[model samples]
Target: MPKTQCTDGVVGAILASWRYDISGISPEMRRDYEQHLAECARCSARQRFHRSLDGALAVLTSLSALFFLFALSVLKHIKPLEHMAFKILGLDIYDMYHMLISAGVAGLCFSLIALALVLMATPAPSYLSGIAVERARLIEARLPERIRSIRLR
Candidate 1:
């Protein structure tokens, strides 16, 4: 019924409400939706769009996890520097250091959990892996002739 929806009638409305994703549904119950999706262009396109969105979310969460990990590593390396500076300034920096480390650790844990959830709740892992494979192929194609020939073996 919405202007953005290209599918006509009740099935379209249902699919739209579900964001065109029936991955959470049981196989038996999903058969109908699967059949409809196969027969319907608009719904199938919407399904692809939703899957891509899920994949992007997974990638973002994974990147966030990596960033948090990097922050923790940087903080670890700077701990001695911070201690020296604070000692010279005659300031109490232990509390601040502990707080920052705690925050970084918490952030890293939360992001990792989020990344895991995204990968588990959607088909993002497969989608992302497919993209990686394509990128690898592209890179390999650009390799020098000698290296390419050696790689083929």
Candidate 2:
């Protein structure tokens, strides 16, 4: 597609304010912006880039949640050295393990809430699903002819 600067600066600014997503707007109100996007390459490209960014943020937050959960699980399996702090080092930090456990649990909860917010506030799910569908089609195209035929039936 040929790159074209926005024809109307005011309309471009308005669309930018909405992040180029007019799905929540009334049909009548969205018509002009839709037309602009169809005619203006810059706004459409910006929309795609923003949606991809939202999808990437959602994915990152979900991965962060998983990592925190994994950290908590690993911490649960580790046994702290008992009595060694008091006898060998003469330090009475008996609550160290408990503190670490508390921190891990807190981090896990925070990450999960972040992930939930990302999923709720962004268009990431649909974007990610579209990506998955495209990937699946590409993989299917790479399959052998005989395997592909067996699946088609």
Candidate 3:
């Protein structure tokens, strides 16, 4: 497929330097970039791709943290792991259990930090919230008139 180019090179360069994120810019400065994005299909697609990447990173980090936490919980409650450590591996149960617990805790901490960094450094929060708001509006529009009236009240 042929590649599309940005309609405005100067504004496109600026947006590219900022990874197409205008959320951190002042409203006055953002207006021009926003207009460029709206008018240029190439830039708009690039912006969407960058935001989707940010959102994917946030989700992956979150899931990593949750999985680590789940691992810790399983280690704490399950006796089979202890038995496996002792019988199958021929290792000291207490030492192996402590090591696994420590690893799980460390992984959970690392993933949480990664998630925090992603949320802080990217426009993922605003982008995701915008999506949620749009979805809410669509759902509300589809609601029965009686329910909508009651909600308004």
Best by TM-score: 3
lDDT (C-alpha) at residue 105 in model 1: 92
Q: What is the C-alpha lDDT profile of model 1 across 1-153, one tens digit per residue?
A: 223445456887888787787777899999988988888777888778887898889989888989989988988888654567778877658776778789999998999899889888777777778789999999999999999999899
lDDT of 2 by residue, 52-151 (tens): 9888888888888788888888767755565454457665455776787788888878888987887777777878898999999999999999999999
TM-scores, each model vs. reference? 0.66, 0.79, 0.93
lDDT of 3 by residue, 1-153 (tens): 118988999999999999999999899998999999999999999999999999899999999999999999998889954475479768877778899999999999999999999999999999888889999999999999999999998
Which residue segments of model 3 deviate by more than 4 Å? 80-85
Off by over 4 Å in 1: 1-8, 22-35, 80-91, 133-153
The lDDT, on a scale of 0 to 1, for candidate 3 is 0.91
Which scores greater on lDDT, model 1 or model 3?
3
| Candidate that beats the other on TM-score, 2 or 3, i.e. the better one | 3
Per-candidate alpha-carbon RMSD to the true structure: 4.4, 3.6, 1.7
Clashing pairs in 1: none
Better of 1 and 3 by TM-score: 3
Q: Which of candidates 1 and 2 is the stronger one according to TM-score?
A: 2
What is the Cα-based lDDT of residue 44 in candidate 1?
A: 83
